[model samples]
Target: MRWLCILFLAVLASGCTAAPGSNQTQGISQDKSQQGAGQATCAGYTFASAEREISVLAGPGNAIGNEHYQRLAQALDCLAKTVDAAKISSVRQQLDRLNPDVKSVSFSAVQREIEALYNAGNTIGPEHYAKLDSQLASLGQAGYDISALRQQLETVRPLAEKTATADNPAALKDLAAINKLPECNGQMLSDPPADLGDVQEISPLGNIGVPGHTLPTPHLYFHISAGRATTNTVPLLAPGNVTITSVTSSFDELGKIDEYSIGFALCKDVYGYFNHVKGLSAGLQQALDTVPCADFTDNPGNRCAKDLFYPVNAGTEIGRVGHLQGNF
Candidate 1:
């Protein structure tokens, strides 16, 4: 029942390697005049100045706390947007040289590896599982917060351990049979779900900013300017032919803001979801109305969702996210 969640953002599909654009204005003023002034200020930054700024933003030990990382990311983003491209590149090179031990690991990549192992628990022989498990255990020595990953491994451990401890011929035969089945090749996306130009910045995976994203989450954030979002000008297209499987609506009492999350199945094994969508399209809303939604609300926030099937073709306009940001 666990579906691999692919966080699609703007024009970049799951496997696409397009370089990120240089328009990042998240947590910054939206006024053109202010932006120009900021850019001018940033243009004069030297490597030393940039390093100081990063140190101040990152705090001691370069901790990946939500607020700390957000500030650091925003600062780097500002440099990318305002400073000369070469200057920014030089700054990164200098920083890397100064701290060679500071490696940038994508949490999503690790999560994917763990998920693959978990998914293949039955098929992967016990010896292979043990070897992989030992390798994963070594990741803790690298100072990563692998608590969540450890919990995930625990779910698959019992099955692997059972096979390792006993001479269950039936289990071995079942595993062989499962391995003989044809692989499930999911459908590839031919179109982007959203307009790339409309997106101010497509944040890298494992971003830490908002309260919901304390840890490095397996999500990509598409930041849009306030003006564009308020006008509901962004379109949420279907990247590929997919069946809408679930829709969740969340209402924040303090902010009094309402948002939606859409989950869909691209193929037999591949599934994806989008969060913080501003509004559902008319057709999607009608389909959602057919089912009774389950309430899973907390005080100051009300969340409800309905599970249903509503198929759409690639490039179909299913919804729009105009509420500042979209997470997938």
Candidate 2:
């Protein structure tokens, strides 16, 4: 979570407002917030804050399926060449002819097999040799002469070192390939939504509380720019097929203005938020109004039935992609 904070500045609204002449000093109550806009009025919700509007630059759609497979293949190739079981069997046959004690035979066969694997370019690090040395010593205690096998092991150690050498270079290449994928590509301001033209001079994303700091920060959050902040009349379009998840409101105590925030469930574990949006279309607002304040806790107490949104065009809108917490 701290990493998330560092990479992306999460959503922040303008400020909170208490009901007029009401001094209640607690966060918004779940029961009242659950009522959403259906309640008698805004009177039910507390801690209403000012909501400021900002647009985000969305991230690219993650690569999946074939993309993942190709990446895996590349990674595998870099770390080690696949083992040749047929070649291994052939070497084992040669070692079997030595027909020494059971311990010596097994130990020598393993040592030669490690050499074969290295010669085949499988990833054999020094640790493999170190473990083989321990095993050979144990076998020696059992009266197996490992002298011949140990000499052969020493002969192949340099080649084994070479097998370990490829990994760093391979890893560098893998990193380069990964950086080109959509998931790894960083965010940038996007072209305007269909009806909206390009935007210019919107506020830079950063800590809302920070002073005079307006620069784009690294974030996984998906964003869509609604063109430049002209008359605040531009419509915020759905980046993709999505279900409205949560609707939040902010109020200005001094200005008596309210701001609305909308959350869209893009997919499982993928969510997006638009903050400080003004003048939501009636349909959009109604959709948001009905969304419940869910328990987003690690152990969720009351999880909402997230609506499904699909076929969302990549790069148009960005959703916040997150991983689950815990061991599999």
Candidate 3:
């Protein structure tokens, strides 16, 4: 969308706020003695320079593309290596406990209940329960076994309450219900631009400010439909040797969100936030190794959770978006 162009231009023209310890290497100079001795002097990266490079690679007629990805990989690889396998395992286990993937079956069942409730002429309160009971009996009498349906309704009761009254019907259908769970941490991104077999219509208002409103701080939308699709929770490799700050999941079922505006932090700002990553594609992994590493020891305080690690599963049949939070 043209908005993407506008957003990028705005970001380029007005650089984001710098994070603490962001410019640790600003005045750092390579000792000429080291050069004479053939020792390598480490240099740090800057968001402005990265943006400038992206703008140039974008060219006058195009937005950032493959070259940009290469640059991004190199940038991430440049960050310091703060975490090891143990740290990665810890982060992965924590994320697993949250289990952000919405159960499609549960979401679909709740959607049906909402529709049936609406059709049954009940809004909320005891009347709704009564109607549900009646429907359950009818199903049982028809040999359909209402027990499973009843359990599903019980599981989705809280969600149904919000969806029934939400102003944005399409946007709230499934997400409204799932966002309340402890796992989502009150940070559900947004409905997939496409229906996950729940959201009904796609009007202008529903799409406006959609995923943008749901974005948290310091995240990037790493849309990866063009990349390989797998059925597992794969590693979203560190662009550099940064630490593992925090890992989160995006609820874009079917990857229909395509692209959206998101708050972003420069790699420098997020440097050292996450540990070194594994399981990247062969090309990306190789690219990461070739990139110079950033020394974050000078910027320890600057390390924080400002990036979102979004990985899309091929089994979900959805395109993907990675939300990288900018330090700003």
**Cα RMSD to native, each candidate?**
29.2, 40.0, 33.4
lDDT of 3 by residue, 1-328 (tens): 9999999999987666454456633323324332322322113334334334444543443323344354443543342132233433433333233222211123345447644432221223444554565556555665664544553333223323423446534324223323332342233222232223422222231222222222121222223222234222232332322222222111222332211111111222222112111123444334334433221112211211112323222222221222221100
Please identify which of the two predictions, 1 or 2, would achieve the higher lDDT against the true structure.
1
Q: Positional deviation of 135 in candidate 2, in angstroms?
A: 59
The global Cα lDDT (0 to 1) of model 1 is 0.55
Which ten contiguous residues of candidate 1 have the minimum total lDDT?
Answer: 117-126
TM-score, prediction 3: 0.17
Model 1, 92-126: lDDT tens per residue? Answer: 55444334134444566667766654332112335
Q: Which candidate is the best by lDDT?
A: 1
Ranking by lDDT: 1, 2, 3
Candidate 2, poorest ten consecutive residues by summed lDDT:
49-58
lDDT of each: 0.55, 0.36, 0.31
Write the number of the candidate with greater TM-score, choosing between 1 and 3: 1
Name the lDDT value of residue 298 in candidate 3: 20
Worst 10 contiguous positions by lDDT, candidate 3: 257-266
